[model samples]
Target: MKELIISSINDNLNNAVALLDAIDSKTYSDDSIGPYYSSIGSHIRHTLDFFDCIISGIDTNDIDLTARKRDEILSTNKEAAKSHIHTLQGTLLSYIDANTDYLIHVTDNMGQGKVTVNYTLESILAHANSHAIHHYATIGYILNQLGIDLKIPGFGYNPTTPVNKREGI
Candidate 1:
């Protein structure tokens, strides 16, 4: 189960990079599909930061402070954002894989003892996958609307698609 979870995360992380590579960064900004709701870069970065920061006991305040598309620092720093996302993705997944035992230890931060139990590594894996896919699919739709072919390595219209099942359409 641990191995499966780790593999799934790595695949999703790679898919993120593929989609990032396919985007025309200049055109994906305040007026883009997700915009204030969730920019592609911000979505990827936030997912990466959430996993990395939460596990490392680092502050996630910075991500929360990031406002709308017009206020995004990553909009002009596409390369840096991609690099940050890649680095965080690798670190968090590796950390989780190495510490699979933590899956059973509930780190409940929810208020009033209303905390939910810790996610199994598999559940956490699914969370991360869903996070990235949700945002990436939005990006795909936006690009398509702009008549831009993403040409992604492993992504399809369907969100749950595995990399192996996709052939760069």
Candidate 2:
């Protein structure tokens, strides 16, 4: 189970790296995408920040989802974003054999107010993976609007999603 979870998260992170490699700083930082007006770089940074939170709180056993870095450089510079992602990848690799099923306290706001709840490290990692994919889908939309192709197969789709239903499939 640990291996499976790690592999899945690695795949998503790799997908993000591939995307960063393909696009330039201009496209990455472009926030003119309409509606939400969020940029690819912003989405990428936000996704990574989730994992950063996990890494930050894992040692102390108190994961706070709200404690995001939200660094502007990460959301405006492609190279910085790539560097951050690589750092996170290295950190995750170091935890491959760690006790993922161990209980941890997670704090996040569902709607009303901030609340702390018990959750396994594995569960939090899984949730972060799914959260990354959700943001990837949004990034995919931004890429399409910018007339750019990810060129990476299944870049923004969940594994359980039907292949036939995937965009550009």
lDDT tens string, model 2, 110-135?
89999999988778989999999999
Query: Candidates' lDDT values, in order?
Result: 0.55, 0.88
> Cα lDDT of model 2 overall?
0.88
Name the Cα RMSD for model 2. 1.4
Clashing pairs in 2: none
C-alpha displacement of 97 in model 1, angstroms?
5.5
What is candidate 1's lDDT per residue for 1-169, written digit by digit as tens? 7666667667777776666676667654525554445455665555565455344432221221122233255544567667866676666556553544544433444455434354555565566566666666666666666677657655533445665665543
> What TM-score do all the candidates reach, one by one?
0.64, 0.95
The C-alpha local distance difference test score for the whole of candidate 1 amounts to: 0.55
Off by over 4 Å in 2: 167-169
Q: Worst lDDT window (10 residues) for model 2?
A: 160-169
